[model samples]
Target: MNFANRIRRAGIRVPPPARLVAGLALLALTGSLLLMLPGIGTARPLRLNEAVFTAVSALSVTGLTVIAPGRDLTVFGQIVLLALIQVGGVGFMVLAVLVYRLIGRQMSLEDRMALRDSLGLLSLTEIVVLTRRVFKVVLLIELIGAILLWLHWRTLLPLSEWDAMRYALFHAVSAFCNAGFDLFTGLPQFPDGVPNDGVTLTIFAILIVIGGLGIPVVADLINWPRSRTLSLHTRLTLFIVLWLNLTGALSMFVAETLTAGTLHAAPVGQRFGLSLFQVISARTAGFAGFPNLEALSPGAHLTLIGLMFVGSAPASMGGGITTGTFLVMLISMWSYVRGFPAARAMGRTISQETVRRAGAVLTVSLVVVITATYLIAISHSDIAFLEALFEVVSAFATCGLSLGITGDLTLFGQVVIMLVMFWGRLGALTIVAALAMPRRKTLVNYPDAQILIG
Candidate 1:
């Protein structure tokens, strides 16, 4: 408090968005330092890049990894990583606010505004109540998931009760946070992930979907008085999620079946599960089940890219332009094709400004992904164009799924991925909005431009 007060007295005004960004950075840096501790590693010393990368990945809730975390980090380190995931996944702001409220600290107006922004709440009036609800929702779901996962592991895999429970808790948080992290890397039967196991995949997939569904949608669903009373946002989000997952899974199922070296030999049921899991994980969950990514057909590659690019819904743990924004732009374009002056959905009229903003986000995301891809491709000439594109999209979407190229990138390429991960996690526009504070106070409106283009 004194530190903040001193900074305030020094005539330096720090905006909430900027402060939020700073707080996340501080957390990452602290986690990185902790990861560097000698006890965190097993005999071998932790590399600078490894430590920093893991910290960023954990804090961003992006599961991209250059090394096997289970093999590299000790149990203590894993716990630290878990803490970062929970804080990052639930959001640092909400956790901080929760702590403050627990200690009976009065949330100031600035704090309230930050909470409102962090949670994507409509107003500040009910933010406190909403925060309390979020704490309950996160804890309850994770707890239940852990218990169920432990039971499943004991029944399916050969593991002791203690070990199973430990793995269960770790994965439960990872799955719920949409972190895509798994501790099965060095566990013998599961080298990469539990690819062939339908039971485990089902549990992970459920957690991923629930986590990818934004907090606003979750809260709305939980609090809705009736089915008919659902908000348009909730309805649109649910519809898009269902539509995207169905189409994405079906596309992968077909593509993989057609591809000779892929899931063709697997049983029909297993094939279906793998396809469904991939599509679900592709939308920012970062888990890769069955038949190695490199073995997949070219068509499947393109499909995965599209899913990663569109990502999950906004105000969610996952990144991308968000399902809502992507669909709004698509619907708006279709509306324009029919000569409608404005975009409309579910009997509600969309404002021109909203349409424009969606377009802007989509445009900026494309530019960032393309530019990063080009840079990485040129520097790492050995890497194929498609692979480069996949890495960039995964990083920019904060989706950790990869074609096994993450560890092979040059220092420059790794830095590019890191920057993209940072920007994608916080959001491209959000960084701009945070750093470039608006100062114009003009009441007079300028005439709109009449430029035309195809």
Candidate 2:
């Protein structure tokens, strides 16, 4: 038989999830190669490991880096990073589909299927229309944010007009992508590590919040009147997002009330602002208003660790197990304690499959974080356990916040970090789906049994 007929006879086919993993892998590889070019970095070409780490970080929109892009890379390299953030934040499938539509090419059956799978759409109907709408909404929000930032920053900083505009657009996109990369520390006229100006913080806060809300939630918001109803996904995403933000800010404020060289030294208004910014950044955007992260109290660090673990909403640029997964698990526990057979929220029952999948995602993610933490600990034995844990969680959650050891790690530790960033971006479910064999239904049905459980 020919190759196609032989494969058909053997019953082999690649699933959409697998295709996503493959596509991302190819993109990351290409990004690394491009970064290694001589024109991108300092006098010398970028090293392989450093280039790979940056590529994965950018494509994942994670914002972690070994080499400082600002001091170590030329403006051209930074622009490439921005482009990666844009494409990665919107997702590979969305960009591919857009290119196809712009060229007046019809989407193939497989393309439609992959787009549906990647975008987390409820149905395949009107996928193209939805894609365009999402793209437009994202661009509109980003453009407006960039303009607002430029207007505010132009008079505050002493940089040239073009330079100030560059910072504005760079940070606006970085914040919107929840990719914590910044030009503040590396650029001229800002000897301080990050911009502490209130307007800047406020703008970043807004962008990070909107970006972390995920595309589906944004669409629900745009079509509110016509739809006249919200999906359970949107409802839970919003409720959890608000709760996490509030709780994170309050907990950090209280925890660092007396700590020195950090929140304690700041004015009351600025203290709250810093707390708000840190919590929001920890929510998945890792920009720093307070640069000396090592100065925070252990309690404050613990609070941040919890927030980072919870992470942002599903289908957003931010990572971790996601707030949706965390809330589902919490609700499931509450229902069980109240003696309910099923978890119910807003007078609706959560399906068993959701609970099961949430459990799997959480469990797999825990294993990933713990395993990576162990590797980082052994690799960097001189660092504190909490610091190592913090770095690993930051990388695995794709939050990009660090305890200041990102550059100090050895090559092996850096590789471990890159792997965690890649893992965090693809996520537990996608990774599992990509690896697991497809199931084939059997003729016979198995009997069900009950067993004692925790």
Compare the candidates by lDDT and give the number of the best one: 2
- Estimate every model's Cα lDDT from 0 to 1: 0.84, 0.85
Measured by TM-score, the strongest candidate is: 1
Per-residue lDDT of candidate 1, residues 245-309 (tens digit) = 88998898889787754888888777777888899988978888764788889998999899999
Per-residue lDDT of candidate 2, residues 359-434 (tens digit): 9999999998899889988878788899999998988878889988888999999989888888887788888998
> What is the C-alpha local distance difference test score of candidate 1?
0.84
- TM-scores for all candidates: the values are 0.95, 0.95
**Backbone clashes in model 1, listed as residue pairs:** none
Output the lDDT of residue 371, model 1: 95
Tell me the spans in candidate 1 whose CA falls farther than 4 Å from its real position. 187-189, 225-228, 443-449
